[model samples]
Target: MSTSITIFDTTLRDGTQGEGISLSADDKLKIAKKLDDLGVHFIEGGIPGSNNKDIEFFRRVQSLGLRAKISAFGSTRRKHSLAEQDENLQRMLAAGVPAATLVGKAWDFHVHTALQTTLEENLAMIGDSIAYLKRKGLEVVFDAEHFFDGYKHNPEYAAAVLSRAREAGADWLVMCDTNGGTLPGEVHEIVSAVGLALPGAPLGVHTHNDCELAVANTLAAVQAGARHIQGTVNGYGERCGNANLCSLLPTLQLKMNYTCIPHESMAQLTNTARYVSEIANVNMPVNQPYVGSAAFAHKGGIHVSAILRDSRTYEHIEPEKVGNKQRVLVSELAGQSNVLSKAQQIGLHLDPSSEQARKIIDRIKELEHQGYQFEGADASLELLLREATGEIDELFTFESFKMLVEKTAGGSVVSEAFVKLNVAGESLYTAAEGNGPVNALDNALRKALIPYFPSLRDMHLSDYKVRVLDEQDQTAAKVRVLIESRDYRTAWSTVGVSGNVIEASWEALVDSMRYALLGLHSPQPVRTEFGQRGLVNH
Candidate 1:
């Protein structure tokens, strides 16, 4: 048997089923290119003819010239119907893709309840669908939907289903944990049994994360002689999710020593994960394994010190292997090593034993006590370090600002802000209106500064988050505001804390603008102390 594994990605089809996840045809194409570059074996484009967007994707994907085979996903022919006459099967053929993945009922319970079809008819649907597609010279992948549950409930019937699919020339017989309830042990035993039953037959595994065991189950199946793995990027799918290819790819390649993607393409894993999340407009969880922002971050003083000496002390694998980097986070729990490491990260050099490092550490603790978190606000931390080290000057001195909120009798509300600033020893005043107080202030501030620094025109806020530090204080509690800003080339985050929400937002906004202006005006090169150019996300 071949030792290499086939990676089939269903992000465009199954991933779109995730709640709040939607992608345009262009977005699907962009992701398809990324996946192809990453060397995924198969890219399940989508169920053609199911929706306008998917149909458009199939039409356009042909010209992408991707290396991966584009698989058109669909169900088996309808019960008691000829495969050639089934509209769904016909559409799959019309898609003109190189492969066809047809899902058919393997669980007897679903056969009886969901499809309301007899066992014989279901088997016929599976067989006819494969035979029809095979006759068209298309590689057919038979998705045995709920095969694990089907086998546990009725092993004989499940084996018969696989036998029929293989006989019908199915290139891949996939056992699916459709409900995602099967344990890893069960997957291993069942997959082993199937491998023993049909020697030399190609097998695959697809699992969902309902039990949070999809990745584990897939690994078990692979160890049990299954050579194909099906999953979605970042584990996106209906309900819980499908197995996460982000976690599976690196584990299979680096840990298991299996030949999945090419060795060079493995480094693109993190970027691909983030790219898919960006196109889908979904937030990739920070704690997600292998590819998340926090996957290789070290915050504790001891951990940072050890990792600085030897990264293997705290990390299982070098993050750079997956296109990510190590980050040393600074907080109250930090030591001098953390401050120095972070300073070096942002192009500032601070001696570990120097008074500058001591002061910066003290200031970080003091600010953190005031509800400031630097872990997610690297720009703000860099600003603090530069100010403490006398490496930067204030870009703007706050004079004063006022906000006016008016509500008409019709319940329509408007907020306006006026700001006075001294730029280059000149006093300037600006006013603007916005949907909210913070927006008005941001608009007024930007209006006052855009002409002085045209680069600021390209800068815009991407995300804003506020957290109440002490809920017991209720309406008067201090709030921490974080703002993420991006210009055309770089993205940075800043943080501020104050008892007033507007004040906190204004503080964060001011820090964001000042950081941008500092980078624009600084005489130093853009490279950090480590000689890496561009902004490094923490």
Candidate 2:
């Protein structure tokens, strides 16, 4: 069996069909460059006939000199239309790309109900389109849309569709589970049967994630003799998603030993996934296989302890292989090993058997019991670690802060905050107005500290969340606030808990500023107790 597999990425085309995913021509071009850098075999840009943006992308993409062949996606001409005269086919030719992906109806039900055409006519459409594209000297990939469902319903008609495409010189025959409802066992069996019947034809597989088995099904198909695999980055697509190439590429090369992408380009997988998510304005799932933030994160006491001795005890593959690093998260469940690992991760030195390490572990459990979570709040955890070790000094001390709200007769409202701080023994005061109390407080705090710590100018809160610990306490319930702050270089998160939401926001906001200052300036530790107002002792 040939080990070389063709990777077909349909992110720009089918991935855009996902909810809330919109990419301009420029965005598509940028992603295409990244995909080329990662060494994918084919990039399905989009259907040029459907949108002017895709047409523009093709025109601009030609100048990029990418290694991957850009494939223009479209259907098999039209139901009753001639291939040469079909507008969609003409657009593909004008796209000026080297490849074409033409999806045609393989299901008899779709042919009858959706296309409202005869089965023989659909076969003719498939044959004519592939032959036309072949004559034009473009590599043609015929996507047998709904092939699995069609095969289950009528095996003969489905087999006829594959035969027509094969005889028409289609470079690849891709069996698609269009509805995304095929099981892995069924996919393997059907793909095996097709490969046997088709003889020398190059078989491919395209699947969806409706059943959440798209990746499993694709793997099964590959095991059954399919070579070309179609998927989207981060699994973005119409319904649940398409098969995720982010997960597929690694599994194929590292586990299955299938030659898919360049071995050196494998490390770019996580970056590519994150870059696409950044451009698409979507949050990459933290638990996403291989690339997610929490993919290699060890939090359990035993897991962290085992990983410290030998990472293979807890990790399947080395995280660095995919441009991700193992993270040791500290929480109530953390042991001495977790603390030691996390301390090392942050460039802090702490003896594993020392009383300081035990104290820190006990303190984390104590804080977590008070509704403070440190797993997602790395900056806060770092600050706590430093404080425990007596390394962090007070850059500034908070004296008092207040918020004011006003409502007019016109139904307009305004929020303002006043902050007083002791910076290097100088009592400084500032005030700012914002759309909300938290925003106003953040602005005011930044105003008071920017002069002392100029790095505060680049830092801004990116995300903030408040989780109420006890709904039974209603409005009086304590809330845990997590604040994510980012400067030009990196981002960090901090946590604070209080019965008053504003007070909780204040603690998190202070920790964010303190963490930023610790990186640039080192001073003596401040007073180490919480005052009556839950403020750090000055």
Candidate 3:
């Protein structure tokens, strides 16, 4: 049997059935072009006759020049209607795709109750729909909706539907777990029987992740003679989800020796998953298989050390193969290996046994002991390395600052703050008011330095987080604040710890601005004979 399988991406069709998923025609067209670039064999556009957005997508997508075959989806014709006159079939043809997939009731329960039609009538609907599309020069795919559950309830009727579609010229007969409750073993056994029942009929599988077994069931169906696998990127779909192509594609190619995409396009799989998630406004799962941020992250000291020696000791495959980089995290749980690895990555050239290296390691331990974790503040750690080694300049030092708040008659609160900075042997003072005390403080600080550094306006704080480190002193507990700041080019995070929340936030904010300036002037470190450090322009 051929190991290569056709990849049918349904992110636009069944994927939009997800609860909060709404996409415009332009969004769907962009996604179709991306899927084509990713080398999927077929891309399923939404049901053409169902909505206005899908109609426009079918019209706009013709100009994209995508290499993949765009397929339109719809249900079989209405009961007792002529195939040529059916609105669904006519709309599918107007969409101008080479292939059209039609879903028909496979379960007797649905035919007798939901569809309110006889089994023989449902069979005729499937056969007539496929025959009509085939005569229009379109390759037809027959989706046996609820196939697994239907086959168990009425095996003969389900097999008869597949036979009718095959006789009527359907190119691929797809088995769908519409309710998403089928087990892997059950899917394999039923698909195996179906393969035997309809000999020479091309078979495919479509599943959902209600039981978290969509991927497992799809694999099982493939093992039992299914050739085409339908799924969505990052598993976006109704209910739990569809099978995740991010997980399924790599697993099939790397573990099972099956080919689902062009070899050169395999590396783009991770980026494709992330791109779709971004467009859908879905956050990427940190621990999702193969493509997540934490998929190959080494956090434990032991794991990091082993990975440093031989990546094969802790990694199942090379991270680069999937376009994800390995992350060596340094926190309270890290060891000397973590420091060495991080320093190298940050371009700090320190001998592992040197006094400077030992100082950096000891300082990190001491700070983390006081709840100043460096795990999320790599930029701050790099700043510390430069400061300790005298590779950086003393930009500025803090002076006394004060914040005042008042309540107006309308129950509105107003706040103001003043900041004084000792910049280049001169005192710079500024004051401002804002919606809150923190915002007031930020405004005052930025105003204080705008004269010395005009580029300070380009950088602003993006996120701020504060966590109380001690519950023992409820009223006076120490707080840790983390601030993320970004300029036009990149972003960085800094952390601070203190008993007062305002003080902690101020420290983190200052560090964030200082780091942002450092990127602007990346001066080389100059060492003196007295073991002092200074910066020299490179």
Candidate 4:
């Protein structure tokens, strides 16, 4: 068995501190439950006394029967007030958490300048707060804020602050790289000194990523005897952000030989990252370590071909281990093997060494030269593959379409869309009104196809993304649109491109619906429920 490292997740606290990311009490509870399910050891819910929302979150999470211990965060007691009489302490206690984390200014500079108190009073506050919480039978974690910078400035004073908390029986003395400027080498040295000073207490490391080194710093601190790691999921926090547990947890378990959560379900790491982002309503970072969409994506021909031969060639770890799938993108740089493998994955069979494959590859490069990228428009690529392999059945063809929009006096816009389609030697015409021309067009197209393909009812646009192809004027911009849709079960995305935004959107929309219908005709085996499964289907 490997050594166990406690995952102290501060997603509810520091994560919410990110700009425009606010979770309601219910959202916090939902996220907390997800973390519990993910096997986190400790959930730092939030600073209960800081706001009514956090207080309510703590109150609700207390009775949640969570396997993970809920911890309420707060600063040390005020200088003039007794620990028991401190309103912040009172609120923390009232929140009824199993543990509490009390942060104190460890640096003499913060004590003098920020707290406007003498160093002696700051030490007194740390001792009193920890002692008070320990006496109340709550496990206490003392956060030594700015301890690295503090030690750099005044090593004796910083060590003295830890000594006070340790003597007061704080379970863990956490050193915070508050400014997030410390290097990994600096972290190892500072943590080593602090660990030596407070020999009996367990050491914890809380790092921010101002220099994009929080994960590296945390790893170094752990190597230097820190036992607990504090971070927010996906590194959501103020400034550059806190240490990302998504990256840290994997590195610790896979590379450092430390035990963290269950190895069997380590695959959930990517899903957990995205789940948190979805709940926070933030756009998922495309390059986030382990979980990002591009984490396992292969683009260049040489890389893609090598990956197909052996994924280990280009991948650090198996994509499935982090609930991600290896994606071979179709691009001008793709080889025949890359195209064949990707097409086969989507159930299209083509001989990689055949002329057809070479022709398709050449066509792809031609289209790419014309500003058609298959990476973001996978649905169009799939259609191309199907057409090449003679698997596509022409169910319907577009004849002509026109759209009109008018602005009303109340500042509302009304849009009218008309579409004509030819299916099985029959022409169908339909018109609809919507809030926007694209929506009206979509509605009209769906209505026209409803009579022929009733399965269209199972489809609805889930998300739409548009990107400008050229860097010139907005009017002359060649736009690419991606449309995501879902039926009763699976979700797939399609892409379209044109100089006109509406045309690009329309192409993506049609391809998305077509993919859904095709998937329904040949459905994959059931794995798990929709909400329980990860976005990447390996």
TM-score top scorer: 1
Give the TM-score (vs. native) of candidate 1.
0.94
Off by over 4 Å in 3: 385-519, 522-538
Which residue pairs clash in candidate 2? none
Candidate order, TM-score descending: 1, 2, 4, 3
- The candidate 3 region of ten consecutive residues with least summed lDDT is 529-538
**Cα lDDT over the full model 3:** 0.85
Error of 1 at 430 (Å): 1.8
Candidate 1 structure lDDT: 0.90
Compared with the true structure, all predictions reach lDDT values of 0.90, 0.91, 0.85, 0.85
RMSD of each: 5.8, 4.9, 6.3, 6.1
In the predicted model 1, the residue pairs found to clash are none
**lDDT for each residue of candidate 3 in 168-260, tens digit (9 for 90 to 100):** 998999999988999999999999999888886799999999999999999999999999999999999998989999888888888888989
Q: Write the per-residue lDDT of candidate 1 for residues 194-248, one digit (tens) a residue.
A: 9999999999999999999999999999999999999999999999999999999
The TM-scores, one per candidate, come to 0.94, 0.92, 0.83, 0.92
Give candidate 3's TM-score.
0.83
Off by over 4 Å in 4: 422-427, 448-459, 486-491, 520-538
Q: Model 2, which residues run further than 4 Å from truth?
A: 522-538
> In model 4, how many backbone clashes occur?
0
